[model samples]
Target: MHKKQKGEAAVITLVIVMILVMVGGLFFGLPLWNRWRAGIGGEAELRQAEFNRQIATLEAKQELESAEYLNQAEVLRARGVAEANRIVADGLGGPDGYLRYLWIQGLSKGSTPQVIYIPTEAGLPVLEAGKR
Candidate 1:
């Protein structure tokens, strides 16, 4: 009878240990799994943000190149006019003003331009028909 009682107590202890282990796992393991999933999601969001920044930079560069090309074309046209007329026209109605106007228009349409601004003494020079 003493030996049988000892065996039964041992079995009960084993069963209690097993149940405790399962309960501990239920409490701890699930949270760890959830944390790992959240970490993965955060990493993916960071990667996506980086990709978006790169794309925006590429787009800005392209727009700058376009603006530079347009500026060069305007300079060439001005040179041609100067050679033909023998008098440099005065005022913001010249090539630079026209280019700035065009750039502003493009920017308004969501196109970034390389030459962001034309510098003047106080601020941007006002466009006029005839002025120095």
Candidate 2:
């Protein structure tokens, strides 16, 4: 009976020691576990920020390319207008001839009433010609 009591006492002592070890580990390891979780969260945030920056850079590049294309189109349009003006000038013979052509065109439209006056050699309009 005495030997059996001793074995029982040893088993009880072993169980109490295991409980104490578990408690001590909880007191020390909780902070380390929290820190590890925080590191994971921070890495995720960094990855998201990098992705946003890449998107912004790509958007800016696309805007610059669009502006370049618009500028090229404007340059081409301006060149075509200048060439058309040069051809018209050559066909009319000179600036004076172009002006005379414009005057004749305005008279042909006749969208409104206008006073008719014939110009003299001195470049003065003969306003009294209709009365004679």
Candidate 2 to truth, TM: 0.58
Off by over 4 Å in 2: 1-23, 99-132
lDDT scores of the candidates, listed in order: 0.81, 0.90
Clashing pairs in 2: none
Writing each residue's lDDT as its tens digit, candidate 2 over 57-120 gives: 9999999999999999999999998888778767999778777887898999989978878889
Candidate 1: tens digits of C-alpha lDDT, residues 14-106: 999999999999899999999999999999999999999999999999999999999999999999977644332234466676566656667
TM-score of each: 0.47, 0.58
TM-score between candidate 1 and the true structure: 0.47
lDDT of 2: 0.90
Please give the range of 10 consecutive residues that has the lowest summed lDDT in model 2. 94-103
Residue 122 error, candidate 1, Å: 41
Q: Give the CA lDDT, 0 to 100, for residue 77 in model 1.
A: 100
